[model samples]
Target chain A: MTATARRVVVTGLGMTTPLGGDVRSSWEAALAGTSGAASITDSWIDEIELPITFAAQAAVKAVDVLTRQETKRLDPSAQFSVIAAREAWKDAGAPEVDKVRLGSVVGTGIGGIWTLLTAYDTLRQRGARRVLPLTVPMLMANSSTAAVSLEFGAGAGAHTPVSACASGAEAIAYGLEMIRSGRADIVIAGGTEAAIHPLPIASFAAMHAMSTRNEDPQRASRPFDTQRDGFVLGEGAGMLVLEAEEHARARGARIHAELLGAGLSADAHHIAAPEPAGLGVSRAIGDALRDADTTAADVVHLNAHATSTPVGDIAEDHGLRLALGDDLEHIAVSATKSMTGHLLGAAGAVESIFTILALRDRLAPPTINVDDIDPDISVDVVRKDPRPLPAEGQLVGLNNAFGFGGHNSSLVFRSV
Target chain B: MASEQEILSGLAEIVNEETGLPTDSVQADKSFTDDLDIDSLSMMTIVVNAEEKFSVRIPDEDVKNLRTVGDAVAYISQAQG
Candidate 1:
């Protein structure tokens, strides 16, 4: 069979999120409609006056799970990736595939910001002689990808797609392409982010892109609700082991879902705001469905990129209607960001895991805190409690992720 | 000026902090690369930290010559004097 014809399947899954430290815990919290956002307890928040005083910090600190050497050498971003990758690798039964046939792809929105800023401070205060030698390696955008590749001895290639919020989804798309194009037989793909620092929060606040509902952190991220002012900042990582369908079957690996196709597009409209009409979003969703050789009628669930911003949510709503048409009403759309908040670079990878789980569990998790659903949203959103899907059927789902730079990505998967 | 024994103990503490190798294991006779298993990056960290601790300058060119824990302690002691 041509490599293009080779099928890719998800064999393992892992993540560390504000909701929980691992995949199982996070998924459980998501299903229970628990919100991860809370008041900022970091001492740095007191040092600087930031408008937004709350965020969805990771439930378990990455440093607590990593070794002292690893924590010292890697920044928080790479540390999260390593932690998730470790769980994912072990979940995949720690396959013994050749190092040459394996690849690692990790995406991060802002890489090692903590390291860069701290190193710069050290340079000005303590002089150049005192700067740590490993600062550059830790601060680079590709640090997470390099660390993952080195950890697993992935020789095929190590890639980092830096497309802001869409970065994580782009990484998974690139991994799918790598396996299809015969570059690698197995790929570790995911997105990680550790940008909850004061500078980023302040920057987002300047753009009015983040919600400043400090009094009610849990209800701040209410996707498709009229009350949502903007997105909420969250930090964590999610990883998946994608192996060729035949390779997985040969090893008797447990399959989670079959990754059918991926679609990526750009708006070319504005830098920060999404294409107001969501033409780009529609194109991405259309392309993903077509690439999967499926139609809107086959899709049953949609894990939307609804970051709870008024404009973004309305635009995505329009995009879903344009692409899915009347079938949008049948899809149990869920915006788990209402619970986990927006994980930025890691959002896509984490949501993709949720989509797969929704298919596997035969239920769609609810979009919490939607006290008043916006009238503009025409689709049937799973709210209040988990919604059940058909227990027996060839179920298909889509996960959408959009970035600030007009980047849009849609991934399609099928129940195995 | 730090005595040889004092330098040895201080250097051991530095090595222990950097590599998690116990201070007791960082003997005067132990080679940094062989016995202590310190890599180049870690060696640089230890060198810079040791320089600050002893208030001495162990130039980069002189680092390769300091093969063992004893060599580093001796260099720091001499540079202090």
Candidate 2:
């Protein structure tokens, strides 16, 4: 850490998840133990034979929120990014910052799959001349970040980190770095994914990464449960407006929580599987704590990346235990994917928002559908209902996000 | 044979669907770029949809000449003839 490092704080949050269209509604739904999973309803679902028939679709449609002109120019993922960015900007009271000093970092696992595949289909069925002119711009992975950058005229730099599931958290972590390094006064950072299409579902099903509980959609994402099979694919966006603490205070903006620090690591083990011993994950947790200048004892709640996969859940548990040792038992571990499903690229940012809310309200949202807790999970899992935090003291929480290609990221948040 | 009114109304529906403008506002005299705020990409979409709906090939060379609803209607009428 540098002596001149500036403090970064979260001033605004916006999300459109399967649970709800915004942060408050999603947080409320999470606390109330609501499940957002359902069977696939697209007409194309019948054309493709997929082993998994269910997923967690966004609570609000992007078409309903954005104008036709906006939607026409932007892909679905970019559309979600723009919508979340606008909401977050508004939530931050539209701070008057120089365009040159503002930045944006939005991430995604797969960028504009719908546009790419549809353009290919159009070319094959119709002709080359029938392809849309904006196809390349829309299909690019950086489209979401570019759209966000254009939205706020963020010229500091528009960065897009594609770390699979950890992309969202990694983006937030990058935002923190940008602010601390004095590169930007404010940054719009988050993740957005709209890959509910048939191809992605088919691919995940082929990899056995998605749940096959077609008969019971809501109860399918049972993270840390003995009967858990796999994660349910979800689509949405999560965004946060991060500004320098001094800048936020100068503008009299309401600080939601302090973004203490972030940790990043990679497992050199497998392309898509987690390290059984969670060696890399533990290192990330320790690094995050150290970066935040916090101790294991400060962490009272954890928004875990427990995607309900049999192997992934156990690995995260082992990772937490290794990182915190005896302190892990005291933390209230909440598997928000139990409700929001696996939001892929948006998981980390959405879960980070949930973690920040958990610290602010001093309430831990429940991990729904944990009918029988897995004996392998040694931590105290908050299930069924929301749990209250310790009444009087400052609290810190951790949000862990691990992704394919061995990427692991952990963000630490402190109560305001 | 598709009449001029048919072509105009058909193009209006495509413009309305793409740009979310009122069908009534898509007059034959209104310029797609100046009046309807249609950009290059949207103009491409309009041309592609018009070609498919009217069963005519609108070459890339002719797209630059299309500026208003009446222009597209006349072009498609001549191509179909």
Candidate 3:
């Protein structure tokens, strides 16, 4: 039957987030509308002299749990990826695979910025003789994928897509293609980022895109709220193990959900802000639905790319209207970053975990701190208390993430 | 504190650290280009990073023939000599 089109299924999942270190805890925090954003506190915070101060760092630093050697060699971003991937690998019961048939696709918006910056400091202070030899490998964007591939001995292929904020979603899309094209039977896939440094924070702040709510870090990122100012920066990673449906079923692995579809597009409009009308956003959502062989009516929930920015939220609503039409009224949009802060490149993958859980539990997480909904956004955004969905036959969910560089991506997942 | 044998061991570690693989997985006597799993760009990165770490300048011609750990150690020893 033409190999059944090489259906893709998610067999394992893992995450390290500002809310919590694992998927269950992160989802729980999301449902509770708890914010993970806070002030800068790392050792390097003093060096960057930045204006935008707060961020949503991982709830548990990878160093606390990972081996000393691992932390020494890998960048903070790669460490998060490897940590999450290891959990996912073990969660998948560490399946046996032909090394040639296993693959990886991980993405980072900015690779090794922390490593590069830190090493530059070392060079200025201690001279080149003492510069760490591990700096280059630690800083490369593809290092996370390479690190994970080595861990699993995945020789099929290792891929990294640098699509800014849409990277995580694009990585998943790339993983889906690997299965569809029969390049790999299984893939370790996700995005990781640790760009909460002061330089980037100040840069985004200079553009007036960061919230000045330093007093209340938790309430700083208020997406779609009338009082919303801007997003808080965050760091972390989310990884998933996607395998061919037949392969996963053959091995009797538990299927978290089906990898229904993924769509990617570029706005080609702006370097930072999304197109005023969200032209690419609509196209991305529409393309994903078509790719999944599904429709707007099937999508009960949406994990929006609402980074608490005033204009971006409105643009997304416009895109939703164009893509889903009348179904927009019934769809429940969850502004997850309203509490998690913007994880930047890691946002899509981190938020996708919440979207998948919404499908699994038949409930939509509330958008907290949204004291007043934006008049510009027309759709029904779940607010206040946790939202419960009516028991349904099958549930479909959509996740949207648009990056600074006009990258737009949408992923659709449904109960298998 | 760094003996000849210890220096040779440290030289071996440079390759292992760069590639994230065990040294036993690759041979000391073999050419890094012909024998190791690393690519050319990675090899270049290894050369640059190792040169800086050792505080020793490695001429481009010497870098070309100095493929394995043994070659690197012998070259360094001769330069120091």
Candidate 4:
């Protein structure tokens, strides 16, 4: 650890997920072992003949939360980011930091796909003159970060880390660096994704990466289960108010957890598939523990990146075993995606919020729909019911998020 | 030729849907930006929706001339001719 390094902590969290609209509702629904997946009902579902019919849509619609003017100007992804960021900023008691020292780092895997496609359709059907002037700005991948920056008047910097699924966690990691390097005093960091449209669904189905369990949408995302087929695509956003420890303390903010540190690595094996040996994933886990100045023995809970894919779940199991060694048996590993579905870019941020809530509440949320546990998964999977944390000690938890491009990220959080 | 009342009502509906402003509040002489709080981007949406509905091509240069609901309604009605 560097002598000049500053301590970063999480002051507030906000999330709009498939499970629920906000952090409190989502956390409660996750603990209750509920599945958010449902059959697609949009008109395009039948028009495209998509093999995968169901997805985990956000429990609350963006239009319901945001004004019509806001929704019209921003894409769905940016809308989600703005909604979650507003909640997080308010939750932090609206810190009175200088605009020059505030920052925003929101990431997305596929930004503004809906807007891009809709604009193209408008041009084709109507004419070139019909295309909206704001199309380019709305369709940019960095639009979410820009929207958040504008909302908070952040002047330090606005960053978007496009690491596929790991983008959200990478954004948080970047926020931690911003504070540690004296670049910013407080940063609103997280991710948002709103690609539940037909094109993305058809593409994922074509790649054989989505579950085809149309008849049983609720039980489809059975991560680590023998009957698991593939992941269900979901959309939403999650944000965290990350501040330097001294700054948060001075402001008397309610600190949820310590943003210990993050570890990142890439498999470089496949563009869409994980490394079969879990080498990169294991390295990220080990690096996170080291960065947090903790060891495997201190870790008690893990929010695994078990996307309900056949190969992905096993690879994560192998990574956990390799990194934790004997301690893997004691950690209460939960696959919250079983309930929330795979949020793609937002997965890491939402799961990190779940990990923080687990430590704060001293309870590990249940991983539902494990009718038959896979024999290869050796860790104790918290299934059917929520599990209590170690009754007495300061709890440490790890949240792992890996993306299609072999981007592996691990964050370590200690209870405040 | 489209009637002035039809143009005004159609434009008002589009503006109300885009800005979430009440339909009754979209008076003909009221300025879009000042009365409805519709910004430039939303103004573009209003123009596009109006063009599609009335089958009239309102050029970019003419957009700046459309400050009030009455101006947009008159422009679309005259363009239809």
DockQ of each: 0.64, 0.56, 0.10, 0.59
- Model 4 bad stretches (over 4 Å): B20-39, B67-70
lDDT of 2 by residue, A1-416 (tens): 55568989999999999999888899999999999999888898888888888899999999999997788879999988888888888999999999999999999999899999999999999889788788999999999999999889999999999999999999999999999998999999999999999899889988998899999999999999999999999989999999999999999999999999999999999999999999999999999999998999889999999999999999999999999999976799999999999999999999999999999999999999999999998889999999998888788999999999999999999988
Best by TM-score: 1
List model 4 lDDT by residue over A257-320, tens digit each. 9989899999999999999878999999999999999999999999999999999999999988
> Model 3, range A36-110, lDDT digits (tens) per residue?
988878776676666666789899998898875578778999999998898888888899889899999998999
TM-score of chain A of each: 0.99, 0.99, 0.97, 0.99
Model 1 C-alpha lDDT per residue in residues A210-254, reported as the tens digit of each score:
999999999999999989899999999999999989999999999
Per-prediction tally of clashes: 0, 0, 0, 0
Q: What's the true lDDT of residue A279 in model 1?
A: 95
Segments of candidate 2 deviating more than 4 angstroms? B28-37, B67-69
- The alpha-carbon lDDT assigned to residue B44 of candidate 3 equals 62
Q: What residue runs in model 3 are displaced by over 4 Å at the alpha carbon?
A: A1-4, A46-48, B1-81
TM for candidate 2 is 0.96
Best DockQ goes to which candidate?
1
Displacement of residue A269 (Cα, Å) in model 3 is: 1.0
lDDT of each: 0.93, 0.93, 0.85, 0.93
